[model samples]
Target chain A: MIAAAEPIEPAPSAGAPIDEAEALRRLRQNEDQSAQYYAAWWLGRMRSRNPEAITLLCQALGQRQPRQAEAGVEHNAVARNAARALGKLGQAEAIPHLLQALDDPDDGLREAAARSLGELRAMEAVPVLCTRLASGPDVAGAPQTASSRLQEPCEAMLEALGEIGLAEPRLLAVIESFVAHERPLIRSAACRALLQLTDDSHWGQQLLALLEHPQLQVRRAALMDLGAAGWRPALEPIRRTLAENSLKLMALRGLVENPAGPHATRLDEETTALLAVMDELL
Target chain B: MLSPNPMAAEPTELIRALRQADSPMGLLLATRQLAEACHPGAAPSLVEVLGFNNPGAAVAAVDGLIALGEQAVEPLLANLDDHNYGARAWAVRALAGIGDVRGLELLESALACDIGPSVRRAAARGLGQLRLDALPRSEQTRLRQRCLDALLAGGGDGEWVVRYAVAVGLEQLLLGMDRAEPGHRSGLKALQELAGEPGDDTPVVRLRAGLALSRLAGGAGG
Candidate 1:
């Protein structure tokens, strides 16, 4: 897999430079939220592999002190930053601590933990993540806002499962249950997880069948899965959907994925049209 | 043969709910799911939702389109002429963020001509994100030079935001070029000049320019 681009690091000023020791010191002792936040950010930006840096970050990850919330959202700034830093550090040693953080009361911390665990590919955390998925929203402590649904832990859990790339039978069963979920997001996530777990061309056939599903979300999910799997069976169905303007972008993607496979000779007209677009665009 | 497979019908049921969704919130929710799925098919709908009045939904749509990668590029190009300028601007942004060479000319033209600050800003950033490495060495050098020239020419752009973008684009191009070569110094020199321009350049532009200059000086780019 292609590594994601590294973030641009801010340049250090000409004044007295703060070394890793100082950054660790500030992260450990700083009372100010903003100062500690910057410290955590810099540690990750520097991609510090130091054992001490990892320890300090883990400590920060477990810190529960309340800090200034960013405008509308309330979250543990230190823990969130630490989780992010740990992921960038790409240290497997940080996995256990991140797994512990998955149970953090703050949803944001839990979300960050789940993401880092995925980045680390901590397969051991899969069972716990599945449990979290089975459990519904932690409504009592969750942010009581309309947007909470969008920020739920369930989304992160699904994403982590996909990233881990484990397709255990129990996990597959759980994911399968959600494929027809009433919520489009969950259903879509379920489809993504299924693709990650199953290699059977049967699932690809099922996804192709879903191209005719009434819900736009399901159709979109099927298209996405087909593209990821490079399912050639989807080529014709994807081509047909391009007639619907709303589905064109996704259909084009499906075509891109299926291009010049065994079905190439059969898709002359479609391929010609697609190549025309590419030629025009390129 | 008599009993229908409940497993097979689940997708159809989900699709029904999505189509029947009544509220803006419902539509937004569905859009978010499709985006999260990274479904290329969601690109058109996501692009359509860019014209929606809801800021949250629009932002989600823009992000979703970007996350779809190269799949979203052609559709975004098609939407460049969207009747709604807001949607058109966002299409420009999604294409820019994807940084596919297919949209390079569109972005270049937008930076050179678009009246909206946001559109021009996105275009400038897009130019920086171009995958010059995919081209042959000669083409890479030629394209990098063209990008540098365009950014330098736009340094005097009236909008502070555009200038800030140009500084960033210059930094990106210079960093992407092979620093061992002698021509790389010219790009670095341009960045230094921008950083030193105290009066006309805003603090942010100057800050970016100075950062780029420092990075190049450190031999960070090879």
Candidate 2:
């Protein structure tokens, strides 16, 4: 027994285990700004399933630190990183924090929050996101940064609502209201959101009608949405649009999105001709 | 004066205003609004504005055209020969993003022979976007092999930026390949060699190579 003196158990290492708590601490309060960024990135990269990581990320989402200039662009790295981490984590618990972050002063942070909300598919955020889509920044006293002036947050909000895909009547109504918004970009975003909201043939038909919209942008958006939604009824219309040389590429894309092989019998002479042309061009 | 809050206007009303814009400045401003609107119907207007002298308006127009997807491809192709380098640059970029085979020929040519680094860079990225996965397996292998060869050749490009683009293109090609396919091994071998080479290769190229290698080894399809 003495000869085989028990191999001494390895001494408990003095180095603190690099665990979630430590990562969270570094992400939250690390003096080295780069370390903070790295920590936030690492948490998402590792796909840490820990609840505390979610909580820390949510808390960090609201934090507005001194603006850092990155590649000549001013932004809050911490909030941006935190919002991105939360989106990657896809934790439901982080939704409220992300929703709150939609109103953050920094446009980048707001965009990041809106994007994260979409990632979580937080249907509850639809109303708030719609409001953000309909209105620019809500804070009266906040300084208008370049991003706010550019209305980037509005784009982010619209995209978020689309990604949520609640398709609730209220949400659809809100999005529909924006379809008529003056900004073609916003209108385009609205079309995308509507397509996301419903697979209804009726909705598809409605989008088809927009193919004749006077603005090329509107027609373009309709073609894109119809294709994305795979609205089979629109195939004929898209084929008709494809007859126009300028619009042919888009219409062909729509037709391709809903291939006619399954419904070959339904193809009219014109559609068949257009399909042949599409085969050549595509 | 253009209304300060264009967001409040209806889509139809906004289109009317964009059409009615009298001066280049006014058209530029309205075009900026339409670009932000993200509607494909704006493609024609945006494409027209792509020829505008104002850098900001041209930039916005380029973005809108790119956003319009295939709708912008033909129009952008029509403008590919525009005298303005900026217009050509933006048109190439939009066409490249659309990734149609129509754009593929020009992009491949540009990546292989363009005098301008920016054009080469855009072409490289455009090559990566060409949905090889959608093609038949034989076509996929053939096209990917061609692309991989082009990218490897581009790795020796004079500009680090172009080399970086090559790395990105290689990653895209590797991603679209079926792991079980024999073609994948060659693509993997190229990326691994690039990753292993530290001399002269920029950090970005090396990083992308390492990532592509890891993705391939991990059996994660791009």
Candidate 3:
């Protein structure tokens, strides 16, 4: 499905990369939450497919230890990071555990699980994502504090659905509802879902129009969504947008690199136009 | 209650050029003109063109029939070619697009097992958007339930497109409902299950279903 949401990598691995044995060793030593978190991030960032590494992360996903509670919100960074690691590991075995994490009480873990599910392109996660979205405050008349629902995984879930593509009309109906959302980011995400569902230029144009939004978050969201959509038609519009040039270049690279794969440096017409645009950005 | 094989007789001389046309361009030209004629005489020749083995001409003929609306339904039903799968599929598309109540049975069975995913998809969508406003409110309610039942059953279709179409049809059917009515909840519940059907692997279907859910969730009735 148009290459699962451009695997957003975790922040550059803490210090240098570690050997698999060392990474596994750090992940197992749960006495220090910081070490375990970095190790989890490292395992995923390094794309470690080792069975033991996967098993450790799957186990970590269930251990919501070292809860970082603030303002009545509880989060286990290690478990959240572990969920992210498992998604990058690319194993069918992690799917069941990820689905379980989806129901975890920790909002952070659920968001992480949703992101990973999209990265893994787990089709089974669609219903779980739908259920989560359906039950969220975004539902009409649901008791809502913008801040509380903002922390929810609606964006990740929407991105996951977009990566998964249209499976059911009911699921699609849910996505369509976000178009009229009071928040711009959610609306941007809905447009991304539509692009993946239909690959139509109309959605690309919808995202492009978001560039005019007064909010930077909404504009940035549109830029990123446009990149994830890989809408070649948006290349020129991205250039014309008032955002920072670096952001424009990054979005362009995402569109060009994604379709042809990272190793594709061929000098085709599309690439030549991209090079020209890149030159202008520079 | 319609003539058997409406195309069996000589196609009226009105479309003599269409009958004589052998080249693709010639056929297309003839068909395009006849499709735009808006004359009752054009209906019979258009029905006859369904079997002509030219897709472009057949598309034009279908458009002509759809333009003729209810007047063309009987002729379309009568001219159904049991031997021509292509023609039959096209007929289903025409009937679906026409939204004639007379095509209801055909639409139901087609959605159930039309062999062609495209045909089933068309039937599923057609069933959802079928015009029932002219019927008495009680009749509309009964027929809507029937339409909902068919859509829910079609949701399990093995082909993702058909399943996706079923989701779309369900959305259309639900949106048209009077929320205060007794059946709206059942329809909404059906849509909720569709969005998250266990073991459903097709994301496109799920995506459409989620959109349907979101749209409903926003409304007072939802």
What digit string (tens of lDDT, one per residue) describes model 2 on residues B1-222? 111223344356556777798875687688778877766555666776755644446656766776666667776776575355445555667776667766777777778877656567667767766765567778777776666667767777776556656656776676776777665676666677767755334443454456556655774322
DockQ of each: 0.04, 0.03, 0.01
Please tell me which predicted candidate would have the highest TM-score against the true structure: 3
- Which prediction has more favorable DockQ, 1 or 2? 1
Q: Give the better candidate number (1 or 3) by TM-score.
A: 3
Candidate 1 lDDT over residue span A20-71, tens digit each: 8877878888576656766787788678878999999998987776654554
- Looking at candidate 1 chain A, the ten consecutive residues that score lowest on lDDT are A1-10
Error of 2 at B117 (Å): 13
lDDT score at residue A273, model 1, on the 0-100 scale: 46
Question: What TM-score is obtained for chain B in each of the predicted models?
Answer: 0.81, 0.74, 0.84
How much lDDT does each candidate structure score?
0.64, 0.62, 0.72
TM-scores of the candidates, chain A only: 0.63, 0.59, 0.85
In model 3, the Cα lDDT at residue B104 comes to: 89
Candidate ranking under TM-score, highest first, comes to: 3, 1, 2
Error of 2 at A193 (Å): 1.4
* iRMS, all models: 17.0, 22.7, 19.9
